[model samples]
Target: MPEVVQNVSKEGVKYIILGCGRTGYNVAEELAKETEDLIIVDKDEKRVEDLRDQKYNALVRDFSNPGFMDGLPVPEVAFILANDREANLAALKTIKSRYPATYVIARAIDAVSVDLLQQEGADVVLYPQEVVARTAIYHIRKLHSSRLALRLYDLLASWEGTLCIVTHLNPDPDSISSAMALSLIARHASHNKLNCRIVYEGDIGHQENRAFINLLDIKMERLTPQMLEECGYIALVDSSGPGVNNNLPKSTRVNIIIDHHKNNTQPPSAVADFIDIRPGVGATASIMTQYLMELDIPVSKTVATALLYGIRADTRDFKRNVTPQDLNYAAFLLPLTDADLLDKITSPSVSLETIEIIGNAIRNRKINSGYLFSNVGYIRNRDALPQAADMLIHLEGVNTALVYGITDQNIIISARNKDIRLHLGNVMAEAFGSIGEAGGHATMAAAMIPLSYFSMAKDKEGLLTLIIDPILKRFSEIVGLDGEGEE
Candidate 1:
């Protein structure tokens, strides 16, 4: 950082760009559009002459000379981008010592030079190899995404009539936003010949999720038995399979699937015409955002806001299960999103059911050796289970939290863990996969067992009490506690 003065001479040049190589030339070209009060310097006489011919303020001078810039006014900033890394460092030190108020951006030879340049008073260090590597990765991903977008367009073009986009049961922000993006893609690709409808099976009872849908005016329908027969094509997003986390029948024929979950063992049963599931990504909305960019589709403010929030929610604000692609996609959407609407969607008031569920989870929590397990009693909204787990995991001395609740037809469970020694997703899958469907990322996971699995209980209340012990015991034992934490 450089010294901040209240005012400087408007007649003086604002920027001094040393080492007019490719990097420096490109930067100056862009900056020239904003102002002509800038100088481009290079030690090569021929290079400086060529730049001068192109109407640039180019100068040939040795940077090692302490008075090379003797006749010039003190520029506000200097860019020392040269291939000669050592020479760049020398120029940086000279500039900093003489013009202590000027900001200096210096190039580094390698990774090690980065630290040395910063220590030598360079305000910013630029490494050529790191810059090229990052740029190469972004272009490579864009190329791949472009090819995939073309395939998706071709598939949509071939289809006509209704196309149902099914999200996971009790749809969250990720699923809802991904569905919106897919619907937009379908309409654009098919030239509006396709009627895209978003469908889900469970209640949108989560307060934040409800706010997201309403504030964005997203249109969706509840899944019914007739929905399968009515829609000509079916696509699932956020959830990989037909029946894994959604109410779709296991045997239903799915036409398309786009999800980000890691499915190591149980792959989707229905063979689809198109499937893009990347386990490394944090959110399906990120994948959808990539499609929009590569295909050159117009994104509305509402859609961008939804997709941005979706990425943040699923990645825990880019803190969990995130990848480079997720971050890149989120950055692409940032400028297009509506910040005020995103604030409203994320900060919705909690519902009474959710508050009650969290209270029950805290009151009934049992902890032993950093492991905590709680039963939230009977719940109408299964989404509350994960909210409870997320809250309980913050308790003092608790490294893992497991929260379960009984619905009318299923026993839903959600767990969160921060312990380095445990992969919570694998633990949940191994403990409950035999009786129900379960699996997720390293930090978080979920499972759902049908009420029929515990048919011995005569009523819902009894069933809630009946399965608590076995659930705790199985989870504790699998994690090496051997039922020590069970009631």
Candidate 2:
């Protein structure tokens, strides 16, 4: 790569760009799939101002003054792409000192700083000479790939083509939106590319979720034992692995995987040529949003609204697990989301069933070990469990809220917390250790218990007792309770 270096080492001025500034339009395009929190910082005020004008968050102050960024979200991941080796190291050091956990990937001008930057905790050191030369080569290869696709289309006698089976780990607004968006991209970009049918596992159990599918009318093929047999290719979103119920047929290979969750111990990855997993990102919709923008694709009002809802719900409206990509993509999608329609999606009315569930929770709620437990009986809508858990966390005595409800198919449990008492995913996973699948974000989690299975326990009382015991014990552990109640 060093021998192929042609362009001067230019780094860190632009981050999370799908393409270079017109050089090839997609410099290191694969990086965009992996990149989550991308920030471009420069000592030049004009450059920062220019970026700010373009809706990029830019701090004009010099790097020497830490106070300059008191309010701004300091970048945890730093890319030292500057040609000057000295300044590059300074930027890397500054980022490291500020964000200890940040992965600093620096561009070494020569061999001198490569090893030194590696020792200095730079996760990746890119040689400028090599990357610049490959940029042109990358563009030509992309052009050829597209040309080949077009050429192949003319040869296909049948209009009907294969389907890209798109689904996610746990179906949510972001995951579904991305699956739809990606399929749309793949269909439009390739002249004679295969048709795609979006599919997913898990219930679309959120208000925004209902709005996305209903308003957008994005057709998602329902996956069943029979459907999996015919599907030849799979595209996974939100999550990755076999532990998830969305597992494709063993013969059906995965073609692409776009996810935002951190990697975990899951089954062998599906066969995918393009795999983009941004762990630091809050939403995969953000990534797709950028692709549409760059490709000059016109997003419909409903699609925009869905994208906005997807980003907002996934990030909790930029409260947690947010990154520059999320913010930038959100800024781009804001105007596209109808102002009047947003009100409808944002504060959709709750069902009477949900309201009754809340009232029942208030009446039968128990506060013990600084935890709130509302084992609401049978729930018509499983979505109510998450809303119940989220509401219970606001109660004064509650640091953790576990809301469990039995639906016809599964016993759904939702957990919400403020402190690091217990990782909700692990808690729910252990609770359903050998029963059913359960995993999610650190602060929020969802578990499914097959009623047919749970109800078949030795006795009715025993089944209920066994299911609720884990919640009680975990809460007691967090609050230092000695297995006894507050009394």
Write down the lDDT of every candidate, Cα atoms only.
0.86, 0.64
> Model 2 over residues 63-136: C-alpha lDDT tens digits?
44444334445444555565567766666666667667766677787888888788778888887677888998
lDDT of 1 by residue, 325-418 (tens): 8999999999999999999998999989899999999999988889888888888977788889999899998999888888888888899999
Candidate number achieving the greatest TM-score relative to the actual structure: 1
Instruction: Return the clash pairs for model 1, or none.
Output: none
Q: Number of clashing residue pairs in every model?
A: 0, 7
Q: Estimate the TM-score of every prediction.
A: 0.81, 0.63
- Name the TM-score of candidate 2: 0.63
Q: What range of 10 consecutive residues in model 1 has the weakest lDDT sum?
A: 1-10
- Native-vs-model 2 lDDT? 0.64
What is the Cα-based lDDT of residue 469 in candidate 1?
76
Pairs that collide in candidate 2 are: 1-130, 5-129, 5-130, 11-81, 19-25, 19-26, 254-271
Scanning candidate 2 in windows of ten residues, the lowest lDDT window is 16-25
